[model samples]
Target: MSTTGLYQDQHLEINLPQAMVSVDEQRLILTRKEFELLAMLSANEGEILPRNVLLDRIWGYSEEIRTRTLDVHIRRLRKKLGLYGDSYIQTIFGVGYRFQRFREPRALISYQSPLFAATA
Candidate 1:
């Protein structure tokens, strides 16, 4: 149960058990949704997590509900992730969001397979 995820050249770390995200060793104050979004994206780094998948996973399943909440949360997460945010979480344009690979940290590289793993 290794829990620390180091990304962005090791400037960012996501501690799963703590549900804590830190940038350059400074803890960020994220809403629960923000933290969950960050955790989900980080856990599945280097892949495009579809909008529907994110909505269901974060907000729980709800009859394909339409809302701008996901975008809002992503914006907040990016802002908190600081300068290299967009480089980390990328927009795939008309599809979904992809968590770009900052670097292959040893602890969690196993999940960084091809982007379409979930769909394929």
Candidate 2:
């Protein structure tokens, strides 16, 4: 599994048969819930998955839980990603989150008038 990043490329060499995730430098020891969450997000990268969806997938909850359990798990996953976490995981306001392979490109167009310009 190859994951492209901004500064450096990140990949998870997983043995699907054995259900193991290994990085180049260190092994990311994940809890059962963490592993499930990571797998789900990785499976659908760049897609904005809602909180309810996550809860249903990971927790298998029929009814919504009034707690920050999903948030906590996400935080842990972010921590596991270390320094490069910020660039990969993005927060969508009033919506959900998305696991990105790379940072989104910034717009080049400028709305404001130029402060200095050559006079004709």
Question: lDDT winner among the candidates?
Answer: 1
**Per-residue C-alpha lDDT of model 1 across residues 11-71, encoded as one tens digit per residue:** 6777777777778889888888888888888778877888888888888867468888899
Residue 44, candidate 1: C-alpha displacement in angstroms:
0.5
TM-score against truth, every candidate: 0.74, 0.69
Model 2 C-alpha lDDT per residue in residues 1-120, reported as the tens digit of each score? 234311223444444445566555667788888877777776667788888888887887655477688888889887887765666667777666787775455889866556665556
What are the Cα lDDT values of the candidates? 0.78, 0.68
* Top candidate when judged by TM-score against the true structure: 1
Give the clashing pairs for model 2.
Answer: none
The global Cα lDDT (0 to 1) of model 1 is 0.78
Worst 10 residues of 2 by lDDT: 1-10
What would you estimate as the lDDT of candidate 2? 0.68
